[model samples]
Target: MQQADIIEGIKGKYFQKFGETSNPDKVRTFRSPGRINLIGEHTDYNNGFVLPASVDKAVYFVIEPREDDQVILHAADLDETYTFNVNDLSKPDQAWSHYQLGIIEQIYKKGLKIGGFQTTFGGDVPVGAGLSSSAALECCLLFALNELFDLGLDRFNIVKMSQKAENEYVGVQCGIMDQFASAFGKEESVIRLDCRSLEYEYFPFPMQDYLLVLCDTSVKHSLASSEYNTRRLECEKGISILKKYYPDIESLRDVTPEIVAEHKDELGDPVNRRCKFITEEIQRVQDACDLLVEGNLVEFGQKMYATHQGLQHEYEVSCPELDFLVDQTINDPAVLGARMMGGGFGGCTINLVKKEAVDDFEQKMKAAYLQAYQIDLPCYKVKITTGTEEIL
Candidate 1:
């Protein structure tokens, strides 16, 4: 369904439940979109750069003010409802409600006056497909609260609050890129974010004949949550160990391949490999940005292939299905380059494929891959779209 129809559906459901309009006279709605990383994966937490854009897929929240300091939420996607006193501002019931509770908790912690409200939200962003469904929900709640309560917080501050909610309250050590893109992304432009500086610039993703296709392996990664934390810890451990020799280093971004090579023996094998992937991934990010700027899709595709190889060989994050998906498409004339995107144990493979050949290409991949792995992969045909805001 279209976003407007989705919003109207939620409003209709709320009225059906409450026997009155949630917004007595009128209601204010807020929207926040999910993001797709065009390139530069797994480099965000390492204090590197990432090229991501907000997608048309989004979460929409319709909210109405309340007199009491009690925030009430109802989500159609999960078929769940939650209520919490804004004065208390503690964690909500665990499970699906935490994302919304995390946003409220962070907003209160920011010294803003919390107010009571009723909200209903839903969206079509495929969960666990690496399209950042969580960020869409968090950002929607944050934006709704900001507007409903007249908190006067800017977009960046809202992004930070949402990030904090995810990091501290929701217990995800994710980087800022997801939430940042959800809040500040522009239409038809890829955001080049300096993760360290929290500064960004938008660059046109010079469109070619290729479609940016996301093929899901239908494998929900069991290691995604835990392994993600472990990888971050490993990177931190590498930095801490290397700091003894290179006092100037903060993250793996600081240690070049040359520096790591000099101290290769000292860092041991595991740390060495971890540091190696990070440093090289950082450089690839810079190079990818340069290539895109010069309208060098061919070179960008090559970098993407190299990136997958590094993630598979050096980072050791890609699984068999991911490996197969990428390997099968490496030499396909219609496909520019393919790589496993997201937390990576198993998820989607982002491919740049010739638009005209997409239908045949997808059919061939589906038949061949299903025969090889006995699992059907879902593919998303996406276009670059803007971030979210309220619609009158």
Candidate 2:
């Protein structure tokens, strides 16, 4: 779908529900694209590097400011509406409202002057597919508010606010990569983010003959959330043990694979494996960046596969469904490389596939996946897009 069509669709829905009561000129529309991590999984919190791009799928918001303090929000996809006072700022019983409420709370905490507003939002981003839909929602609403109220919050600050919404309000201890990518992404390029220093540089992703496909496992294991925190704890334990020798070591990012190997006995099996995966994964991100700059897609794809192997065997995050999806692509000539992306107990496997063979590969993979697990797998073809912006 073209940009114009998307805007028109949102406008049509807004007018239909709101009954053209508000002045069209006063209404502002905004969009924020979802993000895909091409490489560097589980390395963000460790202060390592990540390569991510904002995709075409995004959340759209149509908002109009009100004079009163009452904030009205309508989620078009869920067919739910929520009303709250800015002064109250209480968490809603419904879960989806938390994303918007959290942002409002953060904006208020920053001392930004904002009046209540009525907003209707919906999007094409597939929920729980490893695409950062929550980040996209947070970013779009924050960006809209910034423009509406003249908040003067820069892109970096907006990214920080979006992340804070998730961390503080939503109670998820997430890294900044998702929100950063959604707020700072560019078309036809991927941002190489240094999670430690918050420094980033964009590299060209000229995929004229290749496609970025996500094969969704369609199953999110209950263990994903708890295990994600467990892995972080294990990583911290390893770092503390290494800190005995190298006091300067803060995270796995600072420790080299050789250093981990030399001190393997003290680290034990679990801690040693976690440290190895993280340290080597950081190195893989650097290597992938270099290959991408040289347009070495073949080698880059191989690095993705290697990262999956480490995530599977060493990090122990990959689940059976994720493993099955990636394993199917191992021997296919049409597939360059594939790996399970995101927190990883269950999610999609990012694939670099030949554009010409995407259809055949999808059909075969879908059939094979369904036959193997008796469950359907959804595939999404995503294109890189720019970050959040107001629609003209």
Candidate 3:
């Protein structure tokens, strides 16, 4: 559907729910898009590089300020309503409510004055597909609050605040890439972020004849949460070992391929493998960025395939379903590159495919995936879009 149609639908729903009681002129609308990492998986927390783009899929918030301190929220998709006191700022029992409450808690902690508000939010971003839907939700609400209460938080501050909300309140030790991408993204461009310094450079992404396709594996392993933490600890251990010899080194980002090779014996097999993948993956991001700048889509696609191999063999994050989906495009010329994205174990494989061949590739992959795993794979064709903004 068109962007105009989507906005109108959201506005219509908001008025239907709360327009009668609230003045139409007082209501404000906001939107934040979800992001997709083309490469550089598991590199964000390691203080390495990542390339991500915010897609057309987004969360929309329609809100109005209230005189009382009570904040009312309606999640249109889940058909659930939650009410809480802005002054209390306590976490809720419901899992979905945490995202909303966490943002509010962070804003209050920053000494920003905010009034109570009522909001209705819904989105097209797929849940649990590794599209960073949580970031979209947090950013949309935070952006709305900033505008509603006249909070003077800039985009960078909003990004950090959203990340803090998830880490401190929701108990997820996530990096700033997702929230940063959601808040700073631009249409027809991708941002290359340096996690350590929070520096970024944007490159035009003009893939006129190619498409960004995501194939959901529909299998989220039970170990995803535990394993994600385990990987973080392992990376830390590797960094500590390297730090002894090189005192200035902070993370794997500072360790090069030569450095890891020289101390391979001291790092051992497991630690060596993890450090090697991170160091190499960081280089891949740079190479991919160069390819993007040169407009060499073919080479850029090859780097994506290489990233998947590293995630599978070196990082030990890819599962069988994710591997099978990527393997399906091995020899196909129509497919440029494919890799399992997000926290791994199970999620979606982002593919770079020829525009004309997308349908054929999707149809065959769906049937093969269902036959092998008896699970249906959902495909999404995404377009890059701008970051959080107030809709007129």
Candidate 4:
């Protein structure tokens, strides 16, 4: 979007609510980009590689500083209001507001004195669709607060705080990849992150002829949370059992596929299966990085398909809806490969499709999916984009 268009949009939205250009009461605005994990799902927590980019969709915030120590927040989409006092910063029962509150509490714990503010925020990203909408909201709020009080926090600091908010307050044991990508992503490049080391390198994404298409399965398995934790616990168990032999073994990441195979019989069926999935998944992540850097989209897409199969058969994370979507794209001339993305259960199947066939592929896939499931699927075509930045 053009700068003029952005200014117009911000002014229109701001004035419509506050009805003033300048006020003794200060105001600020900020935006944080939503992200799409290009590849390497469920590999982050295992200390493996992941490639993600911030997408075009984002969370926008218009905040006005207040003299008092009380904070007021209003969600444009929810049409709801929330109030929080800095002294009594506690989690909200409503759950959604806690995402914002959690960050504020963490920042204050770091000895930053923050005055209260009223914020009006809205965004277009779909929630719970594996698009990192929650990260968008939390990161934007962190940035706005940093500027509001002259906190002097760097980008990396902000990323850590945002991750802390999600892990401790939101109760999701996510890795740093999501928030890191949202804070530091560059346009047309995929970040190759070493999860164990927190080191990273950027490589140009050679997806020129291809489009990134997301197909929402419209089915969020209620067991996704429990199952995710279970899988994590299982990985930990495998690491524990292996540590008896290899004392240096820390995470499942420390054990290679070869090592797992050597001791495959030592582990029970479930533990061996979990270990196998993670070990192979990590290898695929490395191969994916090499393929993209070498500009081999075909090879990268094949790795993606293999990763999906491992997640389905060994990890047992894929569901019927996910399988159907991948099955539908098996022989598709347009799609090189399709697989379930995110923590699995049901969310979206990320696909590499020929740009020329995107429209027709969408029409055909939608008709077939709806015919089988009798529900319309939401599709998003995304291009690689930069992360959060100040509009001014």
Judged by TM-score, which candidate is best?
2
The C-alpha lDDT values of all candidates are 0.82, 0.91, 0.91, 0.83
RMSD over all Cα atoms, model 4: 2.2
What is the TM-score of candidate 3? 0.97
By lDDT rank, best first, the candidates go: 2, 3, 4, 1
Q: TM-score order of candidates, best first? A: 2, 3, 4, 1
lDDT of model 2 at position 231: 93
User: What is the TM-score of candidate 2?
Assistant: 0.98
Residue 341 alpha-carbon offset, candidate 3, angstroms: 0.4
lDDT of 2 by residue, 322-390 (tens): 999889999999999999999988889999999999999999999999999998889999889899998
List runs of model 4 lying over 4 Å from the truth: 1-11, 20-27
Q: After superposing candidate 2 on the true structure, give the runs of residues whose Cα lies further than 4 Å from its correct spot.
A: 1-3
Which 10 residues in a row give candidate 4 its minimum summed lDDT? 2-11
lDDT of 3 by residue, 1-392 (tens): 66677777777777777777677889988999999999888999888999999999999998999888888888888878888888877767778989988898898789877888888888899999999999999999999999898899999989999999999999888899999999999998999999999999998888688889999999999989898888888889988998999999988888898999998899897888888999999999999999998999899999999999999998898999999999999998999999999999998999998999999999999999999999888999998889999988
Candidate 3: regions farther than 4 A off:
none
Clashing pairs in 4: none
lDDT score of model 1?
A: 0.82
Task: Compare candidates 1 and 4 on TM-score and give the better one.
Answer: 4
Which residue pairs does candidate 2 place in steric collision?
none
Task: Assess candidate 2 and give its lDDT.
Answer: 0.91
Model 4's number of clashes is: 0
